[model samples]
Target: MNLRLYSYWRSSSAWRVRIALGLKELEYRYAAVNLLEGEQWSEAQRARNPTHQVPVLEVERAGQPPLRLVQSMAIIEWLDEVHPSPPLLPATADGRARVRALAEHVNSGIQPLQNAIVLKRLREKVPGWDRAWAQQAIAEGLGALERAVADGGAGRFCHGDSPGLADCYLVPQLYNARRFGLETSGFPTLLRIEAACAALTAFQAAHPDRQPDAPSSDPATSPATSPAAAPAAAGRSP
Candidate 1:
């Protein structure tokens, strides 16, 4: 597809892009942007995305400069629109709205509050900020999400039978929620949906642990196993 993705293995937003690419079966070159090393703020990366974020999809066309697209949800939506075979959003506007709402519950409500940058700032400013602060925020958002799903009559996935954009957003946030030590067993519905997603090849391929840049003890540069394994200040999904 002549696509190049600036990505980080652990960033939820980047993870979302990864899942979308996998689901659409679109091949793209991956450029790892080491967010924990402050690489997102570097001149080259910032030139690609002024927001200095990972998960920027560079769409390359013949005889033209690569088109840089920023933000995970926006990028996913674009992918859905451009590659419409297996649709990410449902056929109905109402279904699309419901999915978007669920996705936002994680992308905006939970992720923004709990990501490395926001949590770090809170800890720096607050008297005794702890991971619990993020935990509480995530718990609240998940609780609301659970209720929304139950009330909306969610099927195997967030929308109907098929996995959609909401599922993409949910899985990564759930991963981060566990990393931050939040107890997610309370949300049985989400847990069920997560398990279903786990069985999918696309979701499995997009997992942080499966990424080429995933942290490893053998590789010092591995973000997962390194001393600086935590995500950077601007590390959350956008």
Candidate 2:
């Protein structure tokens, strides 16, 4: 089978897909799509996903029909199914439900709130929307995650001692949290879980800054994912 990933360096959703792929040891051709430059809105990308979202996975097998999967959560779950080793979901049915609950908490409730598109729309509708608002939204959303992780579950991971789907979802959102200058010190427990996740090679490799399309310099200094500062090989699909 051949896998193709359409991704942007700093897109949190794309970051989630990459983490799942790395944890499964899945080999895929990385196709860099600069979302900020309206590349994701291009006809070619729109053909793949009408929503024009990054992290679209194309599953191609020689004799079978190619399937396209969109949305990070869906793609991650599919990755677990395609490559069972180092499974993303927990083993037991109850455990799987619990993990999915935590994942859904972030995936559905927290993540979509601060996504690039949502933020853009928010800026238009709410004239006061700014970095401060982003900082507050992230704090509230992730503060809830902190309470859930602390009171509910997560061992070395969200469900148990091994890294699973929850970690994959949460870490990238934290990357986005950092971008907004969210104060994570208030949520010590969540930060602790994130610290552990950051140590894992899967999470580390999945980081946006580590992606081929990421800037060589520090992102905190130059924040735009703008195509102007794009690297020479930025548009190529590998």
> Highest TM-score among the candidates is held by which one?
1
10 residues in a row with least lDDT, candidate 2: 228-237
Best by lDDT: 1
Each candidate structure's TM-score, on Cα atoms with residue i matched to residue i, is 0.89, 0.87
Residues 1-238 of candidate 2: C-alpha lDDT, one tens digit per residue: 8777788888888888888887887666667788877898788888889998888987789999989999988998888987898888978998888888778887898777777887888888887686666777778888888888886567877777888888888888787887887756887876788888888777776777767668673543222233322222211112
Model 1 agreement with the true structure over 1-238: per-residue lDDT tens digits: 4677788888999999888887887766667888888888888888988988888887868899768899999999999999996899999988889999999889889998888788778888894675889889988999999899877558999888898899999999889889988889999999999999998878877778666577642232222212112232111111
Backbone clashes, each candidate: 2, 1
Candidate 1 lDDT score at position 81 = 96
> What C-alpha lDDT does candidate 1 achieve relative to the native structure?
0.80
